[model samples]
Target chain A: MTNIKDIAKMAGVSVTTVSRVINNQPYVSAEKKEAVKRAIEECNYRQNINAVHLNKGKTFLIGVAIPFSNHPYFGLLVEGIANAAVNNNYKLVLFQTNYEESREIEALMMLKHKQIDALIICSRICGWDIIDEYVSYGPIVLCEDARGRRVSSTFIDHYKSFSIALEYLHNKGHHKIGYCIGRKTGTNSKQRELAYRDFCMKLNQPLKPNYIFYDCFNFEDGERVVKRLISMSNPPSALLISSDQVAAGISTCCKEHNILIPNKLALMGFDNQPIAKIMNITTLEIPLVEVGRNLFLQAIENNDSSHQEISVKLIERLTV
Target chain B: MTNIKDIAKMAGVSVTTVSRVINNQPYVSAEKKEAVKRAIEECNYRQNINAVHLNKGKTFLIGVAIPFSNHPYFGLLVEGIANAAVNNNYKLVLFQTNYEESREIEALMMLKHKQIDALIICSRICGWDIIDEYVSYGPIVLCEDARGRRVSSTFIDHYKSFSIALEYLHNKGHHKIGYCIGRKTGTNSKQRELAYRDFCMKLNQPLKPNYIFYDCFNFEDGERVVKRLISMSNPPSALLISSDQVAAGISTCCKEHNILIPNKLALMGFDNQPIAKIMNITTLEIPLVEVGRNLFLQAIENNDSSHQEISVKLIERLTV
Candidate 1:
């Protein structure tokens, strides 16, 4: 806890002399340097890392802004980021934003304040303008497409992936298809919505707003979806769930409700999470961990703004 | 990035004078302060947070060392910690130690280096002596029993909880009970093992080493357990799965293999996670988030070393 002043006082030297000695500057005399070293040893003063970071202009800390730390989606992403960070000797400063814009801004502000070397936003809640404003401060890596933007990102083509899922369902003779998503506002969700709209247009099918389930993030949400499905006058024959957790939930609920999957209610899930495999639910595999690793790598390694797109694949399982 | 020396040079003043001005010390003249302000504005030099942290001797950053970030158990614990951290205006520096001693030491080293204000070991891999060595650096809160130790902790009475589970199973006519665990080395796991041993002794049941499952951390591990169970000459009638995720997996696999629950094998899971509810798997509710919140509170709020033991409750459902 000894400050520079304390070290200087203990060593019988000026504060500036102590600073010079600590920094190993040439101006500090040998006798004064030795005195400062002795004082430091006697006081057991461990040099604060913040001061070292201030001098070096690098904290080796990458800020990761996530919505929720406990969710499976973010958990996988963080695992990828954390592993890459450890490999590079960089620690992660987690900002669990809980989808709050203010919390996301706090992460950006940390970048501007030089508390962290860079930031990788796992799930962004802020507007482009707000994010764009802080680009000059430090590297801001995103998990969504940031192409034609100042910042860098490692993103998935949500539109393409959604289309793939839709086309697969369509080929399986499922014309009345509905989908579930975490939220409608996110860029990925918007892209998926667009894909759904396009699919509807191509098939000349009416887009039933009621059929699209929102805020379906966890396993519990699946019960809500199934309850709604059972009550609907004309429920979709097949459903595309954005998260595998939700899909697994629906699968479990279907068994309880005697709703045979792929016959009465076909279920296709995204992310291909472990639950999907356990429940034998068909899903689109989004390499979230790989995307996370790329995001972290871009945050620390990239000097110029860059965008990397990761692809998703469909894993055929029992449900579909 | 314009440093203090650059700002001083721009203001036509010495580095010490600029430092005094930046620190708002009374020694700097008003004219010099005005000059420094103008230089700061012209150069657009943002005040580095590291410098402020250096002066205040506080980072407002707590280190959270967990084995993995993607696992449900740790995920839920981190969620609790993160929420508490946000409430306290603190950020978490995640150290995904992956159960490696070297990785854990890195987190301890960060505490020693004053990079983080405090550290919370969610699942400790390092020995007590190593952790004890860094106690003087800052508060190191643990998620296991650390009573009679220097550090603070919010722990569960694993032995009592495990006994309660065993008693519940025994009363339900499940004398031949086996348990699946993440590992046998952790303190909590050791306590659970002791309880299991004691239960066998009380029942005059022969100890079956092969009945105990180790490294059963995830859902996929359940398949491994089931495969072994099917091949066994006399598989246990009931299984105590430490994680609900693994329990859920066993439930799913059991159904696939035509093994009836309760009649064939009763499953008792720990940590009543969402998966447990979906699968109707009976489990011991650990209240992990509450434990996590208490852990975080202990890390920041407690001045003296403290120990808080959280209790678990049995939530009965179908799988039991």
Candidate 2:
């Protein structure tokens, strides 16, 4: 309800004089300063922090565009971002798009409107076209995939990791392997699918349509996919899962059916999440916390700059 | 940066006349309106939205005080709150206190300064003195414990759930049972701990000092606790864990050590999260999503009212 102009007008001075006094930018006469103070006291004026922060065009608020914060995968990633943000004297503002196209656009709009300094998209399944449209607004980094764009991204090498798991199973004389992959639209999932297809084609193996199950990158989907495999007349001897949570679900299903792991069936998982470590589910461990930290740092530095891509690693365990 | 006073002063008119022009509140002459408009344009001013928001003492920003957002326990809670806040046209401003006393005070300061409309404390490990001090600033709602305060709260009956768990174990002939709880400083954990003490005392069972472990609430802590239990000459027949993640860790450790569940050593967990369902973890389920939603709705209403508290339930499963 109060502003610099109000104080200035009341003090019989220009708005610039009030601005200088408020910002402590100097070059103000003592008499004018006293008059401005009197006017400010009388009007009960308060400075708008958001407006001032906007003028600098840097809010020190990093927006983390996560699909869902409740899931284990993103949960770790968010912790990484938040931990990094606080250390850097920045705060995190979560923008859960739920993979909705409109919400992604809204995240971009926030940058254009100077609401947030940068954005980190973790496990987004949206198309590249939608992202490309808003790439110019601010810094946009991908957590799971490189996207092949100039954008700075932090991701594990999904193709290589998938190949490594396949090779491990292949070396164990398992020609028939069922695969459970998360939503196929994203670059990461696509890479995994491609790896699976390419490996089978190269080895002259027949790919079973029923063996592959599309999942939502969660434990329930892992259970659902495992059930599909169990119900089939001929299930694959080995399975490669999208995540550790999925592997847990599959392991639970196996226990229910009395199918002992590595004895009756072999399994491998990805993301090497903490659960993976606990369950001893064979998986390719990616530096999730590091990815998150690097993502935030990238966002801060490249707030108004271009994009870049980061890579991932593989960790082996006993499941296979 | 302009206010009603500025326009009135420049137009040589009363503040009431400027307010009438700006808000179209009626009874403003054509000359006065023209003068006000000209003065406003010359000043290049914008209304202080924060000040206007504060004028009504409503920021439309709800504060969610949570311990950790990176874990499934609080992550799900935050998700439910965010979803409800979005649907209701309100923004949930995360105030992650991490159970720290200083950050808790920061949240109270925000409420006192009218930066947040109300506060929804997910769990109170902070104690009653701090809570009482902030209660008068805005409406406060507790998530999992009443704290015996007059605040509105929504949570499950920890005592009932613990009793159910212990009774199930008792019925299963488990004379030697170990209880693993979170940090005892929190109200929720305190309830769980009290339940353990009372039930053990009523059953005429002496509590083993080494059988109880206090964790900081994470997967690593769960794993560490299990390691300690496994090292004992006469370990407990069953273990009750504070969270599903912790249970997963203990289960993983058991698998590695060739220990069996509900067979060689029974295990039960709390919070029946997504992983718990997949793992068939026998425990009492706390409806965290419902807690989050109800607490947020209470916060919205709290914007104009006082404190209130709610109730909780126990969803039983097969862990015992």
Q: lDDT (0-100) at residue A33 of candidate 1?
A: 89
Best by TM-score: 1
Q: Candidate 2 lDDT, tens digit per residue, B26-131?
A: 6778988999888888886444444546566565567777767687889889988878876664555565666655455556555765656788887665567556
TM-score for chain B considered on its own, for each of the candidates: 0.85, 0.79
Please tell me what DockQ candidate 1 reaches: 0.32
**Over the stretch B163-236, how does candidate 1's per-residue lDDT look in tens digits?**
99999999998978999999779999999999999999999988999999999998889899999999999999
* Best candidate, lDDT: 1
Q: For residues A1-320, could you state the per-residue lDDT of candidate 2 as single tens digits? A: 34444577899997656655765657899999999989988986656545546466666667777776577788878777777865665656676667754455546545654556787788675566456655776787777656557466777777888898899889988988988877767777888888998999999987787878786477667667766776889999998888788887787777778888876889888778877866678887777777788888889884444344444455666677
Could you give candidate 1's per-residue lDDT for residues A1-320 as a string of tens digits? 34555677899997656655664657777888899999999997756665667677888899999998888888889999998997887889999988866578668878988889999998888788577778999999989887998899999999999999999999999989999999889898999999999999998988889989999998889899999998999999999999999998888888999998788989999997877877788999999889889999999875779999998989999998
Fraction of true A-B contacts recovered by candidate 1 = 0.75
Task: List pairs with backbone clashes in candidate 1.
Answer: none
DockQ (Cα-based) per candidate?
A: 0.32, 0.16
lDDT of each: 0.87, 0.72
The TM-score obtained for chain B of candidate 2 when compared with the true chain B = 0.79
